[model samples]
Each structure stands twice: as structure tokens, then as C-alpha cells.
Target: MNKHETYAWFRVVFIGTACAWLCWRLFFADATGGADIWDRNRETMSIVSYAFVFAMAVFTRPGKGVVADERDRAISAFAAKSALVALSLVVLVSATIIGTEGHADLLTARSNGWFEHYLFACVMFGWWVESAICVFHHWRDRR
Candidate 1:
């Protein structure tokens, strides 16, 4: 596999693992100091996650002999556009649900506490989608 494909897989796996861990901490695990603790430090958690992702992107260089060709750039642009579309759809749906008070089951947050966290999670999911798309195209290219 090429560096791009490797990096894309890394991102998808990392984000999936991080999200799963967060979900476990939120619902199943009896985290120290309670789950409400994360509510108080949501911003910090978000910042840390964003920083980690950015750091990974920065550090994941193309290596000494690797070079980005037109196809790579095209794939990246397409993936980015697809991810943005996914994000916009998510935001729109979320806003509609929130605005209309349409679905009680959908809003499981305690006192609407999880809305901000939900948006952050959606953004991360969007990133994951982008990486997944990149990986898919790369694999398709191989086949």
C-alpha cells in the first residue's frame, strides 16, 4: 500500500477507536468522577482531539521518494467535497430535529447537554468519512 492509503486507514481506525472509547465512557463504563465530568471539560476534550488529528496530519509526511500526482490530488479534492456534503447533511438534519422537537428518542442527552458534543462528534465523523473515501478509491484503483 502507498503512504496515502496507509494514512487514510490510520485515520479511519483512530477515529473509530476514539469514538468507540468515548461512547463506552459515556454510557457503559463507570468512569472516575462520573460521566458528567466530561460535560464540564468538553471544550478541552474537543481541543485535544482536534490537536491530535492535526498533529497526525502534520507528521504524516509523504516520505523521501513519494510524490503526490494529479490522481492523488483529484482523489483528495473529491473526498473533501464528499465529506463536506456529508457534514452539511448531518448539520441540517440535526438542526431540523432540534428545531422541531420532532423526535424524543433522538435527543437522549441529559438536559440538552450533549448537543455541542454531538456536533463535534459529527465533525469527526465527517473526517472519518473523508478518509474512508480516500481508502475506498485507493483500493478500487488497486483492483
Candidate 2:
């Protein structure tokens, strides 16, 4: 197989392992299932994924020419616009849920508590996934 396929396989395996590890850590280790569920392991996995992405780029392109054609650019632009719309909707939904559940205090650090952390974690995860998708597409374009 080619380098891209190899990298893709590794990424799939790594993400599977990370998810398994996360489940084990969150559910088994921290029975409370709060902010602590997203402990050091999640952070490490994020870093590792990003680092591998960068490394993958090194083998993905020819000398510094503009990689994407106009079609690729247009597609990416549409994808980004859709992603932003989805993000806005997610934020709105989260806000609505928080409001319906209780007071705004549940979303504030000084007043709320672990729920705020949990909410923030969900937002960050969504953002990270979107960013990863964009990066992956761009990498494919370059390749």
C-alpha cells in the first residue's frame, strides 16, 4: 500500500485505541463520570493525533506548489460554511438545554461546577472533530 493508506490505517487504529482507552478511563477509573473523565489521556491522544497529522503532511506533497484546484477550494469553502452553521446550532442547542435544565449558574465556573466543565468538554470535542475533518480534506487535496 501507499504512504497515505498506511497513514490512514494507523490513524484509524490509533483513534480506535484512544476511544477504547477513553471509555476505560472514563467509565472504569472515574465512576463519577464528570470533568475528570477527560483526564490526561484524552489530552495526550489529541496531541498525538495532531502530531501525526503534521508528520503525514511531510510525505504528502511535492515542493510547495498550490495544491488545491479551484474545485477543491470551492468544496472546502462550502464545507467550512456548513461546519460553522453546525457549530452555531450546537451552541444554541446547548444553551437551550442549559436554560431549560436550571439557572445560567450551571454554565458558569464561579457558580455552577462540573456541569460547566462537561458542557465545555462537549464543545471542544465538536470543534476538534470539525477541525480534524477540515485538516484531513486539505491533506488529501495536497496529496
Candidate 3:
């Protein structure tokens, strides 16, 4: 496979693994009524996941021959646009949920923690979608 395809697949697998691990750590670790998951390891998990992604990104440079041509640029632009649209929708829905709720302290640090988590999930999902789209376009173009 070419460098683009390899990088795309690597991103999908890596990010998917991290997300799965985090979900397990957050939701399934204490199913028997132990300490609250969010209160215990949420911060640590977030930091570790972010660091892993950053390290992978910094280390995984595309091969020297994988230059962006017109088609590649177009595909990237399309993926970026699609991701932005998805992210905007997520933001709108999240804002609506937060605004329509009658809780007066929704904006408070303690109360907004979940909202922050949701936003982070949305951003990660957007990034994954963009990468997946780029991969799909590259594969389809080759075929």
C-alpha cells in the first residue's frame, strides 16, 4: 500500500483502539458499584490518549514520494469540509442541549465537565471521519 493508505489505516486503527480502551476504562471498569469512573481516571485517560495521538502524529511522517497532487488535494479539502460540517452539527446539538436544560449551573465548571467530554468526543470523531474519508477516496481513486 502507498504511504497515504498506510497512514490512514494506521490512524483509524490507532484512534479506534484508544477510543475503545478509553470507553472500557471509563464505563466498564467499575460495573459492580465501585468508585465513579469519571471521577477517578478521566483526566489521566484523557491526557494519555491525547499524548499517544500526538506522539503517533509526530512520528508518522509520510514517505518522501507521497506528494499531494490535485486529486489528493481535492480529496483532502472534501474531507475537511465534511468534517467541519459534522463538527458544527455536533456543536449545535450540544449547545441546544445545554441551553434548553433548565439547570442554572450548567455552565459551572463542575456541571460542565460532561459537556467538555462530549465536545472532545465530537472533535475526535470528526478527526476520525476525516481520515476515513481520505482513505476511502484514495482507495476508490486507485480502483
Candidate 4:
């Protein structure tokens, strides 16, 4: 596979694994009395995520040959449009749920940084969605 296809697959895998682990740790692990590694090492994990993004960018950097062609750009554009739609749905659903909780609770959640965390999740979800779309399109093109 070409670099773009390889990167798309890698992005999907990495983001999917990370998001799944995070969701489990955040929502289920505590109830099951499982490990609290995520809570204890959140800052470290954030740094690691940043490093991973940097590494991916470096991996996709332009070489002597052409970096991205028209097809790659088209795939990315389509993926991005779909990702935006996914992100909008996530936000709308989250907002609707939060809105049902009333203004006082909303203020409290905001003060507790719940809103910030929600925004972070939204952004990550957007990237994951985009990567997944890219992977599907790339595979379809190959077929």
C-alpha cells in the first residue's frame, strides 16, 4: 500500500484502540473495581498522545517524491466532510442530554471541568471518525 493508505489504517487502529481503552477506563473500570491507571496518569497520557500525533506527522512528511496526489486529497476531503457530520451529531446529542439536566447542574458540571472534557472527547471522536472514513475509502479504492 501507499503511504497515505498505510497512514490511514494506522490512524484508525491507534485512535480506535486509544478511544476504546479510555472509554472503558472512564466509564466501566471504576464500577468494576478495575485499574485506575487512566485517572492516575492522565497527564502522562496526554503527553504521549501529543507525541504520537507528532510522530505521525513526521511519518507522513513529504519526501523526494510527491507526497499526496489528487486522489489522496479527494479522499481526505470526503473523509473530513463525513467527520464533521459525525462530530455535529455527537455534540447535539451531548448537548441535549446536558440540557435536560437543568442550568444549575450545567453550571456545576462546567465548574468541574466536565464540559472541557466533553469538548476534548468530541475533538478526538472527530479525528477517529475521519480516520475510519479514510480507511474505508482507501480500502474500497483498492478493491
Q: Which residue pairs come into collision in candidate 3?
A: none
* Model 1, C-alpha of 108: deviation from truth (Å): 10
RMSD of 2: 6.6
9-46 in candidate 3: lDDT tens per residue? 77778766665665454335544132353446558757
- Give the alpha carbon lDDT tens digit for every residue of 1-143 in model 2: 33433444555465445545544543355343444444533466567667866866785675555455675556457656755776678778867876774755434422233344344444444444444555566567668
Error of 4 at 16 (Å): 0.2
How much is the lDDT of residue 141 in candidate 1?
Answer: 88
Ranking by lDDT: 1, 4, 3, 2
Better of 1 and 2 by lDDT: 1
- lDDT against the true structure, each candidate: 0.75, 0.53, 0.68, 0.74
lDDT of 4 by residue, 39-111 (tens): 4455676787789889887998897577988999999999999999999999898778767746554355232
Query: Backbone clashes in each candidate structure, one number apiece?
Result: 0, 0, 0, 0
Which of candidates 2 and 4 reaches a greater TM-score? 4
Model 2: per-residue Cα lDDT at residue 13: 60
Model 3 / residue 8 / CA error / Å: 1.2
Per-residue lDDT for 89 in model 1?
93
When summed lDDT is taken over every stretch of 10 residues in candidate 4, the lowest stretch is 30-39
After superposition, which runs of candidate 3 have C-alpha atoms over 4 Å from their true positions? 20-36, 59-63, 101-112
